[model samples]
Target: MPTSNWNIMVKASQNPPFAAENYSIAEIKNEVLLQIRSGKDFPVTSAAISLIGQLTSEQEVPVAELANVVLGDYGLTSKLLKLINSVYYLRFGEVTTVSRAIVLLGTDHLRDVALSFTLFERLQTDASDHIINLLCRAVYAAVVGRRIASQTGYTNPEEAFICSLFHTLGEMLTAYYAPGTYAALSKGITGSGAEESARVRTSLLYLSLGKEIAQSWRFPARIVCCMEKPTVKMSEHDDVYRLSCIASGANEVAHIVEESLDPEDRQRKLEKTLKNVHLSASLISGNGDLTAPVEDVHKYCSLYGITFERSAIARSLNQRREENEQAQGPLKRPTNNTAEDAPFDLPPNFNGSSSSPFSSLPEAQDDSETVFTNGLREVGDAFLEECPLDDLLTIILETMYRGLKPFGLRRTLLLIRDARRPAMEVRLSLGDPLASIKSWFSIPITAIGSDVFNIALSEQKHLFVNDSTVPPIDGQPLIPSWLVEHIDRPVAMGVLPLHIKRVSIGMIYLEGEKNFFTTVPQNYLNYVKILHQQAAIAIRQR
Candidate 1:
């Protein structure tokens, strides 16, 4: 949201409000970049990556020298052999050793193969579907971009392959490092947003993150330029321009194919996007002057799990265009086309015409209740879902953020109720970085008011203060001094206590845009209540 107006809100999206966790979005990037520069973030320049880089270069790399690097890691050697041997379609003889595979695949083809396999081996984590999709897109784009590069007669298609492969580096890194922020931001990502493609959401976010890492690693000037893809115009046959165009085109096509559920919608969008890269629908569909490299696209799809035919693609694109022609309607081209390498921009602000605090409220599709219930079920598992203590709290906090409609609340905090101290300690704050990891929001368990959030925790009841300035129960200003010390202004808040067999354990506190807390229908509030009650039941008696 923050292009200034939502800076705090957008910044809070990642810089989790935890103890001493206050950081601007820029600061968060600097911190992450520092770690990356120190070789602490992602394994970008591992031995395998370095060796693959050498293999990808123009100079002839000695087979014995390349094999020595591969031989250092038993796992890498085995994988190299298996991958080479598995490419039965290539009709290559079985490659039983890394040395032979290197010689057989040759310098150029070998580089492409090694880069893909090395990256797969390095960045592979216990990834979720979103993360896996991110990884897959990088690899998919690499293959597709390489195909495009070869057709366009780029000097080094291999270079284009790698550049396109890491185009989403920022997005993938965020998903891996800060799944919390990744999950939080993921809801509104529908690919084509009001200003840019849905993928632009993270792209806008991670461009800086990716650039810093790429630069720090001292990658080639052209590759780093490709990563930033700064606003510029280039002549035809400009190597940099061709690389950027092919990579961008590949990614756009991959997104249209993979993310969109509606085939007709997918086709309609793909044509408009390809235009930005100076590619026509006819070229891609093989109906143009240049023969379409349909085989390359199909091979990439089959190698990955895309599992769709070439005819299906042509049918979607051509049929949609035919329908538009018959109606005399011009197909709408999205104004913010990242595929063209347009000046990267943010979506309009939260209160601006395009978005809102509730922009991403979970839709039920056809069944309303399942939306909340299914989410709660997942949260229930998380509450008891054993994890490393550090990660356990993060999962709990993130689950709570989603369990409550993410877009519905401005700020929510997880508080650990301490009976002996008669107070609550703010453990986590969602969407409010100032409250995060700080005791600034703590309130005594026995706050001297009927509507105070802590009273809800102490009494094991759901407490809703419709207006903090005026009491809902008896027309008194129930907002306590402890709360006033923390809140800069009057605000409404709710607290639902966690209990085990009706025994109070802790509480969940949520605050929204002033009176917005009161506007939530009781039925929706009950969903949050049920979430707490179910999570409490799952907590083992300890």
Candidate 2:
């Protein structure tokens, strides 16, 4: 039996006054929160059990009425179902629906289920990693609590579930409302304590809040007292005390498993906890092939006629122990997102070289023939196979340099649109390093001297600058000086459209004096045209 140090009425009095003898439904709910933190899982569990009676009685709850309640809190219903489906439930695989969950889990479990629904719903929105971690830890602890209930043959599995689930409700609210402060405290404790650090003190603050809420709600005295003094003695035969012990041990295990504690000390604590529970040390060690899978554990327990209740208590503890053991090893941190994490950048020339008759002339007649065709096919194929998006752009620009070197084209620039920033940023370049080229690489789509920029911005691939003498499109010189100085030689330029799926991607700028194209071999010019199309497709896909 559970004992109490605080009166339910006294605790309820701390909140708005309410009649305890003939308590209303809201008052009963208020008390439910109190009982949870008080370490008395039974009263709340009992109330949930009582609800089962009401639900199944001759006056069955109207299906529409139940639907409205469930829809009002869809997340709660979902979580309840998930919990029911978890390894915690005895019927494990068969039951699924909320209605079924209520029937199988009982009224006592339902109340606790409702509490868990509210608890996590609140925690998900919290910003503090510390509190979030604590929330996770608390859930693990709740797992322990439910396991204990199972072992002790607690009739209401949902009550045990709720008790474990909301035992750390204070932590949930703290993480939700004051994450920064919680984070600071967590940092301070971890930095100082290594494995020796104990969060029990920090957690007590939230425990107090749980206690306060329980008292305000007018929960049973058995639970109210436990909330007021968590250290209170439990009878050797007290099932609730056993449940609380399992939860307490589980929380400590979570920290150890996450390696948030000192290695040697964490090991010692875990070993002692396991010994006290008569569990196998190898189960938590996570050594070579020694760990038990949940299914195996279930099988083992069933062989002994052990209910899921006891199995849950045992399994969660051991799992956390294994997690802690793993955490004891050196930590591996994730680095910044690299090119490998991104998709490939599609080039404008995905269709390959056109087979048009105009592109087969000899090199001596067409100077631009070798510009983009030289090694263009080989490099483009290699880039598609090997390069990541960031480096792909660089490789594409380099490929352009390799292919166009014989043409005396001297400079090439690639600009790509930034989705997040929604602007054009310079991607690749072939020019003097001192020309502020970096800034030119990623110019805003709305501003720039590049024909590619104009093409992408206007969704037009047919832009052309037949005459530099024409007025600048936006009061700026049509031919940028960067282009003039970087080219190493003056030349007229032709901007031809690059398209993919009828959408404008970018433009290929062919530079040379007028009639230069008449001199360059058509085969090489065809290569440049093909490269442009591939480049357009590549960049767009990225």
Candidate 3:
């Protein structure tokens, strides 16, 4: 599915009227879940439901089995791996595989990652700007919750993350599954007299519906508890109550940040909200720096592929940062040199762009190289940290997939030798139409015969064919006939072999469009080789 804003209003006219006042909460909850389950995105919903069940089951789920469940979905696997490797979770080093991530970060963290992605996936459909804004607020709340958990030394910060993320589940789902009713309730609850009753009823409806979904999804008892507005005063000794406070407070802060334009008004509202929850501003920002939480929100947005600039909360936060910076004025640098002593002369014959040769390249290509360079650094870090073999290989493959994207990299396949059979099969792939081509990419290995792919594996050499249709001097085509018959003949291709203790394991197959490998820099090719060598080292270590 395409990653875009979710369009809840697309089927709004077709939706039945969801009058919360008429039916019992149970009836309404069941109806909503049924509607969601029967909708067009049921397959995605079902998969998420199944994964949640496995993660939260009473019986112990084996590490390998759990990892398999996660890896079964391409998007989930990609996002989960990325989340685990993010700065927030990167404690030991780079985590590559779901199994190793489970071992290192624990199952609770993995469960939260899965939940976060599921929520993100649901809200990411093509939608109105308002709905997208709501989604951004939820993400902001979750990020704040995680930070609060960390600052307060909470044992399970992931729990805090999930609690805060789903804090507005009731409101968000109502908006998504029943936009008309949401709009009606939203409008009706904004005044005195009968409006106050409407407000109370609306709150109850949202809260009850959210609770029902949580219960149906088998969310932990504590999470469900945290979803509700805390009615009682928080006790210092009650950790769960404190956690609930954090979740609720973070959610309120998210709303305040988005809804309030004036910094003073926002800060005052934030302070009041935190005070009501028995939390201090310092708990969120250790030094009472209000802008800290806002910066963290932007950082998390970047980490999760969210368009930070488009978020209303982000704009509000930016304003707050600007105001705060202006209030404090610019900082003075501690310089030992006088104004005349400081060197300010430009080098001889130096143009602004003379410092880097890449200045002449397109911005996208430069960004691509930067991504590849970062990927190489990550792989090197993983090696130093002795990251699990499977995880390291995944990182390497994902890096190559993302880095080569600018070169018209359409599909990347990792064909590994099956231990039990003399055949190379597609172990992993990245890019579109994978289901169509993944199954057809098996190559039989034989001592007597030679194909370009087999030859690269056997000889442990890299091959770059700019155009597969052109016959080499040997009059042999680089791409096998079977491949051409099953899939579109790629205009350009790259084959980098992987080895373990001098024995061939697999090769990374990169397929692209016209002139794919022609203009790529030598340094980029060297980076690719380094990534392959890192994979080899990982294999040998295994």
Candidate 4:
């Protein structure tokens, strides 16, 4: 359908891709340690902190002077001045000085200016998507800040808006410093063949980077907190969290017409995200008269030269109604299955028998096939319609664990998309006390240093580790080592790629006992595939 909603176009299930540098914190830490050991001067943390203050100040700073302060030994003032005048910064009049521009932006904004300049100066290289992406983000953030100020009530809304806009700074920095780590994460998630989950995982990874960088820069505690929990945190009084939420929400809405999203899906996702973040639905409904007289949301959009119409609200709302009707109607799954629908057969059990789920059948033959038996199909369907999205996922994982018990598989790990961190977060754990930690920090899946991550994600294929002697994937070596050494307990593990359509969603890790396949069954792989399909749909709705 021709919809004007950006969120629907972007797909809430798939968060925008973020550079996975943040989730690569361990690698960064290692680099820091090595630099310290080698006595090589690492980038001074103080420099990052100082740069923030300088950028926010109102000094009309020149690019050269700004560069001088940030780049330290570099005398690239002229080049910087040129960059400042580029089409990116909408400065008119023949004011050729970087200092003048700095003054106009004000000290409060100088932090962002300095940050923008310093980041570009340090990381600008041919084909470096990190700096380019950060610049795009800066421009996007500034515009978002301006529009948010016009649309909402808050003192110094511009300042608050700007802060919210650059919330993903850490991700850029991490991407620049550690491209390998970021690539690994991207590959692991995308290779999983679930585009939706891949994007969300990327976003989570990006958020993690932003949190780290914000902390590294020692920006305000509230700003840091807001960056960490952009969609989940509560602020004290009129804080950045509120302003950022509104900005993000507005950005989502604005993008619908300006970008692409099924207006209906956009509204639905926004509604849910806002509720999840504890924002009063009234505010997002655009009924709150918080907008100020000087504030021109349309003008702000114009300043950025992006097409946005205030009058489109009516159209958007109507589209949303149509969407609700469709959503409420009978469910018909998309027909074109991506890699997620590929077929594979199960292995045989040891007793020279098929060892299927049914005792009469050979062990392998019994366990391999999954039929729509005994209300399982209905249970799955009901689970889809009634269960809360997150709870639905939890139950699905729990069911898989139970299903594997007959084969002696004990532990299972499921990694799902989390927007706050923008990476694959460990959703549930069958065993292990470490899994209980509520705030399980996510690492870029690509950094796991194992090919298993690649095989599971990219090949959309299952991995069987009988002897644990296999080498690891590019970023997921730990999985193999863990599976092999943990064999003393239960070692049967299966990696299932999850996706909807061509959009990759996420992945599931199932583990049973060492002698798990004593009786292999038919279509066992297909059963898990169904689990992943249902899980993805539930997550998308959530």
Candidate 5:
């Protein structure tokens, strides 16, 4: 470990070099960088990048498509939904599904989100605590930089973010992949003096290499420049310079927050950093707590259903006693990529039904047409060991409800016809999952043709009526008298009689925001019929 002999003194960043056992530190660093630069497969990055690239292409990508891609990587998908619901991106409320997120972010923003996440996901593999901490700091800087840029009237805050986030890519790659070199080079990192500063200055070789990687990826020049020349003057007229200032200023703030002992010092640095970006110095003057950015990161992680390195951080802050109990020995670092924690493998509402209609559909095809389908089949094998027939039936109805969701059907009622009487009773209703059914409990089975529910029941057929399409008879409505009397007003409705083995069980009534059915495609109505038939079979068998 003598300073005079650099070769013998070289120690690894965290562990042994992850290269050919005999390779030197220089060869290891160069080899790893070369692999990332041109190799067809990257140990961690390619799969993430490829998947993200597919999901974020120019064409209109369906929510189903996003969900489908995420099925194989359920934890990743959960993180996406969680991130979408994070405070930064959250617009409305809890987004239980990917399709809902598409509606909110639109395709372009979704693409950006996918890109950001894939980068994060890829870096998570076999990363050391130092690197993970650095990545989180980068993320915090990115978020803070974006906000700072926006407050300063810079147009592309997202560009500012990616540039800033990737600024530490070299350091990250070296720490995990070229540990020997990182270890040796980081040996002199001891002081707040010029000697230490000189050592860090020498470390710029990796940062310079990071810029090359970013450039190779076809990133905008300004973005590449922001990472390369983040020390550019904040007062410059050009967007690149301004962006660099914001990104650099935010990174400095992140570091100050990470290192400062006094809360007031951190607050002062944060205010100064904000002012450097032309943002109001008073913005974050109230809080100097270093954990604020970490909290936001944890909040975002929670949105992704991710509980790992950061989760441990959050829990440790609140569980010093628990941490002490574990302090009896060296602690094993819990990995973030556990397969057991997949958030959407079986959503709470799906009730673990293997017979879900989403199973029968063709495996998601890349042909734009079916690319947007959900991944029920992805986790189709996972279902309740004892899923009762009733749960399956409910799953069918819920499928229909979500299927017709694009058509805006707000209510669907399944009225079963009792053998003892000519009355159709609303045995199951969908809308408010918790609402009482007693109010819509029953309807008489009239013999009239105009009686939508009765005609479907008697004829054992499906009746889909678009009120707008039903021409008026002598200027009077063609709908049944029951609808006119019992309902608030006439609206578009579809009635499908459920039958099994030639015996009538019930009829389904689908109501929508007036004329909702008119816009619904014929294929959708056909699917509804299939669901009705499926439900009937399930009921009869059960």
Candidate 6:
């Protein structure tokens, strides 16, 4: 359901003389926009729409700019990082920075990912079954389209994904903005023209509305073109036309998969659709595995947090896979007796043993160690990729924050020397979100002081205070009075100075509760120092 005004307007359009035919396309488009704006969540929706437009625009957006946009949205940043680190993209190793992700995944793929997330967030607020089904189909189509593009050797599979995902944008928006009209259109009305004409008009209404919105959102020309249904006979050589065919064919395949038809019927319909689009049957059954794409769909659904089990398409696809597997029977192993062809098996002495030999081995590394190891590897990869300075610094800081969590890491801040000022200021922070505390991170470089922070930076050394409240034998406090007044005496703290060619530039400030530093293992502390070294290296390289 939509706003009352839009519902009334759509319901009124079904009457004689005031029907949809009487209204110009422009009028309908304006009404749609107005109704969308009139909704209660328009402000949030408008911002998301604007972000999608920026992400998907045709112009070349700088990596830093794109990374900045993504970093501004905490949820999107977290999800995007999670997706990049998922098994799907794990071949690229761990990506800790948005800029690195954009570089590895390409702007097109990340743009589509961002767009899908934005649309899902905006439309799923009051989503009904219809909306959920549409969203699933959209994602399913994108996955299928990417497969088709890869099979056909298209230059950009991600572009194909975007085209296919947005193909149903108009229908989805219609269902959200004017469910009554969408329902009425779903059940066709008796018209004077041929059934095909009526069908064409109905399809055009949705496509045209989608095109209008695409234009408003500044989506690329190829995406808008793919939104339209392909002509009866399209040129296979034209890239845009080929993408359009792929999108249309993929969407049709999605519909066929969801149908109540038997496996044979569904296969026949799928083949027919692919043939009409000039695609090979191999796309459907690559290497005789018909369920690969279905499995991929499920993986993507998990990444997007969509409940694939609830989808009719998922059920149908699973049923098809089961039937295919049943027909193939149980797999038989090779009977060859050659030593090289022998199957892997456990030792005879261990097979029937009650106790396991591995029981005496040391346990696996803890989560914090894994985090530190992964962070180190990610930093190494970033260096190999020649990651931009800002992004590399972000990775270093984030690594330290996450890896030190087991040691009660409360907040970590990167304070860099201001180029035009006599003081260092907080450039990046993690694990804390208090603006007041963040602002207090500034340290005047020229101020004569021997406190822990100043000492670390001036001497280019690392300082770890196990208990800030205990004064040294000199009867002078190590913790500065200003820090005590503002932060109310942090129980523990660590400072690692950043230097370029032996000249101090800044310091990393870590604050936590009691036993933060006392509890940290020597190896973990070494890992933190390694991360600090990487930050210094990044700064030197820059």
Task: Name the top lDDT candidate.
Answer: 6
lDDT of 1 by residue, 350-422 (tens): 1112222222322222232554555454444444444233223333333344444433555666677666797
Residue lDDT tens for model 3, 1-542 = 11110112222322574444344435545665666556676466646765666554636544444554565565676666666665556565654444456657666666666776776676667365656777778877887787677767787777887899888777877777666656655655543423354456557777787777767776667777888777798666787897898899888877776763564665577788888887776653322223223434554554454555676765655555455458776423336844222221122232223223212222322266766776777677777778766566766776676667667777777778999999888766656333445567788887843667778877878988888776654766567788778555547888888887778888888888867888777887787888888777777778
Give the alpha carbon lDDT tens digit for every residue of 428-521 in model 4.
5544322242254242444322455545665555566543444544544535443344356535456676666644457777666554554445
Scored by lDDT, model 4 comes in at 0.45
The candidate that wins on TM-score is: 6
lDDT of 3: 0.65
Q: For candidate 5, write residues 1-542 as lDDT tens digits.
A: 22233333333332443444343435544655764555333534555555555555537443444433443354555565555655565454544444445555665555556655665665666446655566766766776676666656788776776666766667766565555566556664544432644345435656665666655454445655766544434555777777777667777766665562344665677777666655567446343432223344444433322333442233333243233336654333236733222211112122212232222223212222122123122112112323345444444554565567556776666667777898777655566322345354466766564455666666878777766346756665456555566556556788888777776777777887678877877766666666676667667766
Clashing pairs in 1: 2-6, 2-7, 17-436, 18-436, 18-437, 19-437, 191-198, 192-198
TM-scores of all predicted structures = 0.47, 0.38, 0.60, 0.37, 0.49, 0.67
Q: Roughly what TM-score does model 3 have, to 2 decimal places?
A: 0.60
Q: Cα lDDT of model 6 overall?
A: 0.68
Clashes of each: 8, 53, 9, 87, 6, 0
Off by over 4 Å in 6: 1-26, 52-78, 94-103, 124-127, 189-194, 215-221, 231-238, 261-272, 275-292, 318-373, 384-390, 400-496, 506-530
lDDT of 5: 0.54
List lDDT for all candidates, in order.
0.54, 0.44, 0.65, 0.45, 0.54, 0.68
- Using TM-score as the yardstick, the better of models 2 and 6 is 6
Per-residue lDDT, model 6, residue 264, is 68
| Model 2 segments more than 4 A misplaced | 1-68, 81-97, 148-158, 193-203, 217-233, 260-265, 273-542
Task: Give the TM-score (vs. native) of candidate 5.
Answer: 0.49
Which runs in model 4 stand beyond 4 Å of their true positions? 1-104, 121-138, 190-208, 218-222, 230-236, 244-260, 278-542
- Model 6 has a clash total of 0
RMSD of each: 22.4, 24.1, 10.7, 28.6, 18.3, 9.1
